[model samples]
Target: MTVLDDSTAPGLVGPPHSHGPRRDPAPLLPDPEPVRILGTPAAKTFDAELQRDLYRRLVLGRRFNQQATTLTRQGRLAVYPASTGQEACQITAAMVLREVDWLFPSYRDTLAVVARGVRPLDALTLMRGHAHSGYDPYEHRIAPLSTPLATQAPHAVGLAHAARLRAATDPAAAEDLVALALVGDGGTSEGDFHEALNFAGVLGAPVVFLVQNNGYAISVPLASQSAAPSLAHKAVGYGIAGRLVDGNDALAMHSVLSAAVEHARSGRGPVLVEAVTYRLDAHTNADDATRYRSAAEVDAWRARDPLTLLEGHLRAAGLLDDAGVAAAAKAAEVLAGEIRAQFDNPPDPDPDSLFTHVYARPTSQLREQAAELAARLDADADAALAAATDAEDEAR
Candidate 1:
């Protein structure tokens, strides 16, 4: 029996075939070693102003993550998936995008959301158990901090594809539009991840997928989650560019993400970036990380902390002096205070607000449910008033 090859049977090989030369996947593959900027000669050429800005944001992001975690302990926040050690990736992801571009962030990407100009308290509303989404997504061009894993990937692709279609008719907006979707390592296992990437590749959507491979997916380690060479390598199968960067290295992440964003904006299609970072904190305030990871492992990542890595580079370069360090610390303190004050007396969302955005035109069932809820609330108010009046009469 003779076996058929792709040369004779193009149909058997699927969509990778075209009339011209077959695209080489080798050039598109990520580096064997994760790209590094700090502790290297490349650090010298990096823009001093951008370096300093990244440093400030990383400092603020670390403080923000800590503050959110503390709120969870204080019962102020319902839950928080703190991106403590992954601040580099968070800050860089937000910094790379243009104002017109859209950002689809994961639940753990609160830092990214705030970095993109979303108010600190506003970003926390969904996690605070108050409303569906805290701020208007259209106004800020940020999709809701997605609670469901990998779901935002498809949404980002759809938006990017739509924008590309719009740009085809209007050349003025062509270069200004792109979309970014962030996902965690654990989310990569979801079927949505595959679907989104497949569609993005086929449609040539102007989107970037940033996968922060922060060692674990809650309790599951990366080893158990994937047997692939690296998360970035998965992009090769989709026929797009892939990148790997030191996620803890702020400058490296900023450089890589900036390139990817520009490529997407220029209509080059999607790029998948896998940032190798570590999550120092537990899954959340409620998790016991000690049960899953050893203290030695956590200490190792802490030693190579994103803040200290950038701070060390800045200090050695003389771009950041004693006064500069003090100023950054003071700014972070101010942010922490602001977060505390806002969350201390968080605004109570109206009970009826839930039904307001349920649909463009609410269905009959939703209308009935809303009426029932309103009636129940009125009855409770009447009962409380009657009880208070009876007590007053008895006292008289």
Candidate 2:
């Protein structure tokens, strides 16, 4: 015993070194080929009503993107990130959620926000340079359109985890509350994305992450983003399930997102979905897409447009005819007209609004700054009035 070698030592070679238990990676892995339902035989079995509704929404979403981009050009919006080619992912993400559920959208997801019952104009408030978010987040259970990359991911996880904890004590209060966060493929490279996944997996939070992999993140293409087989594959590392769907196929997006929402609502933890899509337009009105990608590439994605795909499927299934197509287009035009009418009469800027929501309780420095600004505005107004009075008297 005193002459025991390293191999025979109790501490050095203890029981072949077992590390608890190993988890099966197969269940977490995503399908090699993205799931397709629009052109597949599965389309025939999908609900007729749901297919019609999805088609309608996809058409409306596309028109919304076009109108919003036009607004940016006309100076109505400070900036607009059009979800043109990715309308299927945008609309389906909103449609799958319940009223009790929450949606966290990226800056480019205005279509999703509006589809979730938020007013179309309200969805563009931030892009219009408004100081506050356009709509009441509580009313819609939708978070403000997040401008920072991957920041919304953690917020979605935290809210879902808190809801799960609360549901543990008050069973009915849970209502199977789930949170769905939308992120661009570029966001996947962020540290916040990684941390959120880790936390979500460890806590078994009821959250779903939908990554709209629209080829390029701004000017950087997906090839430069990550070398992972697919963005969904990243979920396996966090012990969560992963899914890949044809982002341009409305039916596929609807099916995948619905399943993901149900999976999370059942307290099965988080799911990461990668929707292979393309951003037909530039990243934003400010970016020149031609600088990075070719014209042929954009045209190729345009051929697989979400609206076109859904519309084709619906027509083939006899769910949509000439009249139905006309009706959907008419509704979309009405929405576009409403948005334009609202922008025609711009809201007057309120100087006080600058400090309104900055803090719950203003700090001393903030109060001082506010006072200084107010005094300056008052003085300027008084000077203008005096000058006007003098001009009037001289004319008399």
Number of the predicted model whose TM-score against the real structure is largest: 2
Candidate 2 Cα RMSD (Å):
3.7
lDDT by residue (94-170, candidate 1, tens digit) is 99988999999999999999999988899998888898688899989999999899999999999999887877898
Query: Model 2 reaches what TM-score against the true structure?
Result: 0.93
Q: For each candidate, give its TM-score against the true structure.
A: 0.93, 0.93
lDDT computed for candidate 2? 0.91
TM-score of 1: 0.93
The alpha-carbon lDDT assigned to residue 157 of candidate 2 equals: 98
Residue-level error in angstroms, candidate 1, position 73: 1.2
Worst 10 residues of 1 by lDDT: 1-10
